[model samples]
Target: MSANHLEQLREAVVKMNVDEAEAIAKEAMSDGIAAMIMLKEAMIPAMEAVGELFGEGEYFLPEMLGAVDAYNKCFALLEPDLKQGEFEPKGTVMLGTVESDIHDIGKKILAALLQGNGFEVIDLGTNVPSETFVKKAEEHSPQVIGLSALLSTTMSEMKKVVELFEESGIRDRFRIIVGGAPVTQQFADSIGADGYGDEAQTGVELVSRFVAAP
Candidate 1:
C-alpha cells in the first residue's frame, strides 16, 4: 500500500469518520501493517491533531468526543492484533478516582487512551482510598500512578495518596499524575505530583511522555 492509505486513515480519524477509520484500520492490517505501527504512525498523530484543534477553540466537546470515538473504533479493530507479552509495553499505569469521588467517565477515558497508546493500565475504579493506591503501587510497581477527582472536595484525597507514597519512601519508584474536572496544574504542583492532565487526551500525552522519559 502507498503512504496515501496511511494519510487517508489519519484523515478519517481527524474527521471523526468512525466507520471509515475502522475500515482503513482493518485494511491496513490486512496489508501487513503492524498494529503498533498503525498506532504510532496514524492514530496517535491523528489524536494529536485533534487535540490541537480542541486547544484552538476550533472544536467543542462534542467534536472532541467524536474524534476520540473515531479513534476508539480504529482501536477496537486493531486491538486483537496487538500481541501481548511478545513485546514490552510503553509503561504500566495505575489509575483510580479519589475516595468520595464517584465520577468515573474521566478516569475511564484516560485508561482506554493509555491502553491504546500501549501502556498496561490497571483501573482501580471510583472511590479509591489513598491506601489502595499505595497498596497497588507496591504490588504492581507501576511506572506511573494516575489520580482522578471530579469534585473539588475530593481533590485533597489525591494529595493524601501522593504524601502517603512519599512518607513510605517509595514515591521515587513511580511518577504521579493527576486529572479530572477539579484538577489543575497548580494544585498538582502543590501536592507534589509529577504531572497534571487538564483533559483526558492531554493526560494520555502526559503519561506517554513521562513513561518515555529517562
Candidate 2:
C-alpha cells in the first residue's frame, strides 16, 4: 500500500499534476506514514529525476516550472503533517536573494528542492539586506545560508552578508552559499562564500551533502 502510494506520488510530480500530488501527500498523511519517509522515498527522488531530465534537455523551462510548482503544492499539503509527525528534518537552511537584486526563479527552485529533500528552509524573499541575513542567521541557527544575486552590481552584497557574519563573530556558525546569474566558483571564492552552485540542482546537491555530513 505504501509502495503504491509512493509510486503514484512520483508519477504525479513527474507529470506536474499539482492537484494529484497534493492529494497523494494528504492521503499518505491520513494513512499515518511519516512525512519524511514519503519525501525521501518518493518526492525527493522524483525531483532528482526531473532535474536529470531537465539537464539532458528532455525537459524544458516550462515543464520544469510546472514540475516545481507541483512539487511545492505537494510539500505544502504535507507541511502540517511534517511538523506534527515524528519526522526529523535533515537540516535547517536560510535562503534569499541578496540586497539590490530582485530575481528569484532560481532561488525559489532551490528552496523547493531543499524543502522536498527534508531540509527546513527559511526563505527571506528577494532584495534582502546583509543585516537582515545576519540577524536571521542568529535567530534560526541554520546549517547553511544561500545567497542569490542576478546582477553583477548586486553580487557584492553577498560578500557584505559574509562580512556581517564576521563582524558579529558568528562567521563559523553557518556555511555560506552563493548563486544566480553572474555568480561563479571564482566569484564565490572571492566573496569568501563557503560554497557556490552554478545552478539550482547543484545548489540542492551541495546543501544535501552538507546536511548529511556529521
- What is the TM-score of each predicted model, taking all chains together? 0.62, 0.62
Candidate 1 residues 67-104, lDDT tens each? Answer: 88888778767766653443467888999999998877
Residue 32 of model 1: what lDDT? 87
- What are the per-residue Cα lDDT tens digits for candidate 2 across 50-129? 87898799999899889888887877776655555224788999999999887775676677667666788899999999
| Candidate 1 runs further than 4 Å off | 1-87
lDDT of 2 at 97: 95
TM-score of 1: 0.62
lDDT of 2 at 34: 77
Write down the RMSD of candidate 1 (Cα, Å). Answer: 6.0
Model 2 residue 134 distance off true place after TM-score fit, in angstroms: 0.6
RMSD of each: 6.0, 6.1
Candidate 1 pairs with clashing backbones: none
The whole-model lDDT of each prediction reads: 0.84, 0.84
